[model samples]
Target chain A: MVTLEILAISMPISVLLGIALGTARVYGNVIIRGIASAIVITFRGFPVLVTLLLIFFGLSDFGIYVPPFWTAVIGFILCSGSYQSEYVRGAIRSIDIGQSLAARSIGMTKLQEVLYIILPQAVRRAFLGITNELIYLVQYSSLAFVVGVPEMFAVTKTFNSLYFRPVETFTTLAVVYLVMISVLVVFFRGIERRLAIPGIELTTK
Target chain B: MNSNIPVLKVENLKKSYSGRIILDGVNLEVDKGETKVILGPSGVGKSTLLRCINMLTLPDSGKIWLEGVELTNPNTDINKMRQKIGFVFQDFNLFHHLTVLKNVTIGLTKVKKIPEEEAIKIAASALEKVHIPNTLWNKYPAQISGGEKQRVAIARALAMKPSIMLYDEPTSALDPQLVGEVLQVIKELSTAGMTSLIVTHELHFALEVANELLFIYNGKIVEQGPPEEVFANPKHDMVKKYIASIYSRKG
Candidate 1:
């Protein structure tokens, strides 16, 4: 359940940060956009392993003694958020400019236009991409074992070595990951349906 | 509601895109309870003019006043002022995600801070004024016909209770049969004394609705007078040509 706990916490943080990052890149002034762009490029350019290792060990280099579990969570959020922002940025661009103009015509402020009009439409369009990210998140959480956070894979590895039950222990780990991924997919499917606009084509993949 | 002050006034409006002028020295006045139609060929800056009056497109060098407030002034609280000016676009720009009723009430709730129940009451009356029955109020824009969509757009604007309505080719996007439905609603609203300025190519509809017809050519009001006078004695060659073409098409 530690795996689930990490994912539950990291997922919401990453998604919120992803939205803020994408909006900054799209709507911010030159300096803010530059900062958001630089973060996306840096996090995305390095491997997820590199980020995890850096957070797990490099904090010691700075004399920041964060717990290993929190270090893994921080790493997951930063890396996953960078990837999610790319999808969000693409979705925001796909929405019609007419939506913004219509909102503005009725005297909605610029921020209100983004929050009430543009983001709702963009988030719906970004759902499929976000679901794909959720699937990756299930798998990515397993990487926490490398930081000695004792997630599912780490526990399975220890059990396999102690009991020498490679078949049972590894297979159970595989099934758990499978169940988590399937549940994540179904949950996102429900969200996609609830958020679907009247005219949009709802694909059932 | 003073007699001397026009509901809307534009002075020496000019706009250019990349040095190619669209509206050059355009000027006009719309009095309270008057419907003035600007008849022009497409690309003569009619849409730009309407957008400018709404400040959606800022004029390059000019001034606009709505009910004695100079809109061009930098200190004008644009969002606050915009609530008092209604604008309808050619392609009915309804909030697609919202139902017809919510589309009309959204501005009331979000912008004007009206309570939901009260906003719905205002929306219902506005929708009724535009002839949108309650049955269709819950439907999204995609579920409705084009004429209904345009009417909802009008209702969305009208619910704000603006001093003047600016319609930018309100019926140009409709099918021929559907065009009459939307125009009929506008006619009813105008005849009932809604101050509106319409930019459209529908000469027949213009004659039916407008008290004054302003013929625009190359971004200038080439001829202006009562519809009957402009049709009977068009002063400029451009106006004469435009009226003749419409009459020829009818035959």
Candidate 2:
């Protein structure tokens, strides 16, 4: 339940942030592009655990306090969003330049070109990378336990300590993670197929 | 909407890329309902001229008027101006992700702010004008043939109901067999009294559909007149040579 809650909070926020940052990096003017690039590089480079620690613990030192659960959510969003931006950027670049040009020649403004013509195609191209990121986010939810959020791993640890059954408990935990990841992989595969372009296939090897 | 004003006019248009001149003081005009074909050898700024008319490639120095609006003025709203002049590309640049119907309707609904039902009505008529069957309207660009893709592109532009249509080598990328269908559509548009400026290498199609033919060479309009007159007289040595090469190839 905690794992699902963390994912529910983090995934949508991260995806939206990633799209905004990615588009700014690709199409924004000098100042915006530079800022987006800096954000993406900084968050991608910093460790997620350290980032969570910084938000939850280090910020209190500077006279700001955020609750532990929200801190973990913020950390996951920042970290995942930066990585997601790179995938989105790659997908946007992979689209042919002619698509935007065609849209413009038909009298669509630049914003309309990106919104109607470019982003739909870019999202499809980014699908595989995005699904991979989602899986990573699911696993990374376990990191919330370190910040005192009683998520999946945290609950399982408490149960294991009380029961004193290391082998059985750990095996069950591994199986649960495997089941969760498998469901995610299968669900996204269906989406990828449904949204697949009729004549073109995008594959990541 | 003034009948006296030419649909499109270009004067002293000049453009260059990296110290290399492309269009050098080029000038032309297309009256309402006139079809003008621009014929030139490859790399002679034919496509660049079309791009400049639409301001897709801004001219280094030029004046362009579409329906008497000074498009060259910096204050002109380019996006709105583009709605008046529809442009078709050499590569049939259809939005690959969109259905044929959506490709045509997008501009009408989004840019023109027409209601979706009205846009669909206009789009359907435009597609029908290009002879695209109703069955193909739901298909993506990649699902269609090269010729059908070009027709879809034409339909896309036509649905905007522009005063003038600019075709930049509309058939250049097609297979030899596919070229005829695309050219046939353009020929029909010309006969239907649509004002058009076409850049093409197809000498036969130029002679057939063009009310006036402009032969560009070395970045200038070297010869231009009614197609029949230019073809028969061949005033310039360069034009004479060009006609000879095309005829020899035909033989």
Q: Choose the strongest candidate by lDDT.
A: 2
Candidate DockQ values, in order, are 0.72, 0.81
Tens-place lDDT per residue, model 2, B1-251, is: 67898999999999999999999999999999999999878999999999999988899998999999999999999999999888999898898888999999999999999999999999999999999999999998889999999999999999999899999999989999999999999999989999999999899999999999999988999999999999989898888998999999999
The numbered model that scores best in TM-score is 2
Judge candidate 1 against the unseen true structure and give its global Cα lDDT, from 0 to 1: 0.89
Off by over 4 Å in 2: A203-205
For residue B166, give model 1's deviation from the true position in Å: 0.8
Residues A76-160, model 1: lDDT tens digits: 8888888888888998998888788778888888888888888877877777887788689779888898888889998999989
Model 1 spans > 4 angstroms off: B1-3
Q: What is candidate 1's lDDT per residue for B1-251, written digit by digit as tens?
A: 56789999999999999988899999999999999999878899999999899788889999999988999998998888888889998999898788999999999999999999999999999999999999999898999999999999999999999888999999888999999989999999999999999999899999999999997888888889999998998889988888899889999
Real contacts retained, model 1: 0.57
Q: Of the candidates shown, which would achieve the greatest DockQ relative to the real structure?
A: 2
Q: Which ten residues in a row have the lowest lDDT in candidate 1 chain A?
A: A196-205
Q: For residue A148, give model 1's deviation from the true position in Å.
A: 1.4
